[model samples]
Target: MDHMLRRQIEKIVPLTDSEFDHVLSFFVKKKYRKHQFVIQQGDPVNYEYFVVSGLLKSYILDESGKMYIMQFAMEDWWFSDYTAYLNGAVANSFADCLEDSELLGITKENKDKLCREMHKIEHFFRVKSNYGYVALQRRIFSLLCNDTQKKYNELFELYPSLFQRVPKALLAAYIGVSRETLSRLSISSGRKTQED
Candidate 1:
């Protein structure tokens, strides 16, 4: 499990064995069952979590109780309410497990301390943040364009396994479409549905 995190970090910056161990020391491992909340709305957000296995989603609910998924984090992915975590504010959104999960969480204080102690660690996070920003921009563009089919196809191309793993209704929500509309799109595209 530790090796998984090391692999992810090494993708951006190479770390020696001792350095990896030092970095790992700052994180605390946690496990959660499916449907369990990792971060709930109105609660303080403390840690940014790295998934060792399983899946989780971060989302918000509107006043009318409509859910809008911000992002999903699967194995090797990192997630948190960055606005809350970085600013030391309460979470406006929730993060919950989509599957039984193992994660490594590093608190904001520990993260800052680690970065201060290791310049390479700071570089790693900066690069990761830039990538996250680019992805966010692309998602914003997709939502603004109002092209459901394009969004569906782009998601399918990027993460085909999500079709198998995620419920159709949740996928619909993520793609900004109604479930029935998503079913139609799936049929039109000849893609396998979650039921299959």
Candidate 2:
């Protein structure tokens, strides 16, 4: 867990030995079963998960109970209801496991403790959030502006090798399209792969 955390942090900022130790000391490990809900809408969002392996997703269910995929966090990714977690408000989104997941978690309380103790950890979070925010902003802009075909292309471009492992329906939801539309897009592209 410490190794994984260090690697992930290194991607954003090089941490000193003591800083890494300080951050690692605060993380708590947790596991979730497939199809389990890590967080439900209206719950108090307490933990921000750092994905060690497997898949998790953040989504919102409308009044009709239909889901809108907000994001998927695979290995080395992070997912949480940021608004709720940071502000101590009720979550409007649900995070669930698409596959059995092993995660490193830090609660809002622990993170605050770390931030107060180690300025470096706070800096690490700020930088990491900046990167994530930019990427999310770009993804949202593309989804809102582009056609389905373009969105599919952009998704493949961003997550180069994930199509083989993830279900197409989930991918469709992530790209803001239907399964049938994705099928049509695939056929139109001269691809002949069958779904797993």
Candidate 3:
């Protein structure tokens, strides 16, 4: 677990053994079973979780009871209701385990202390946040301007593993398409892949 965390941080910034130990001191490990909710809407969001293994999906349900998948996080990904975690607000979204999952969680207070104590850790988080922002922007642009096929193809390219790990119906929700439409897209994409 420590090795996984170290590897993730080292991708953005190198850390000395002491520094890594200090960083790890701020996190607590936990496990959840499939279908368990890591967080529920309207709850006080206390921790941001770093996935050690398995998968989770963050989503929201509208007043009409339609569910929208906002994001999926698998191994090596960090996930939370960022606004709520940062501002002490109640969560407006839900995070649930898609599979049995292992996670390392850090509270905002501890994370702030870690960042304040280590410049490199602060830089690593800033870079990660920037990357996360760019990804969200890309997703928004694709949703607004891309056709169904393009959206499906782009999602497949970006997270090919998701197609295998996530249910087709949920994938459709993430792409803002009907399951039938996703089926058609899948068949077409398979054919295109074979041709290539």
Q: Identify the candidate with maximal TM-score.
A: 1
Off by over 4 Å in 1: none
Evaluate residue 43 in candidate 1 and report its C-alpha lDDT on the 0 to 100 scale: 99
- The predicted structure with the larger lDDT, 2 or 3, is 3
In model 2, how large is the Cα lDDT of residue 128? 86
Ranking by TM-score: 1, 3, 2
Give the Å error, residue 118, model 3: 0.6
Q: Please, what are the lDDT tens digits per residue for candidate 2 over residues 1-196?
A: 5688798778767888887877887888899999899989889988999999888888887899777889888898888999999999999999988789999889999998998887767888898889998998998799789999999888877875567666778778788788999989877976543374
Predicted candidate 1 versus true structure: per-residue lDDT over 55-141, tens digit per residue: 998899999999999888999889999899999999999999989999999999999999999999999999998998998898888
TM per candidate: 0.97, 0.91, 0.95
Which residue ranges in model 3 land beyond 4 Å of their true spot?
Answer: 191-196
Best by lDDT: 1
TM-score of 2: 0.91
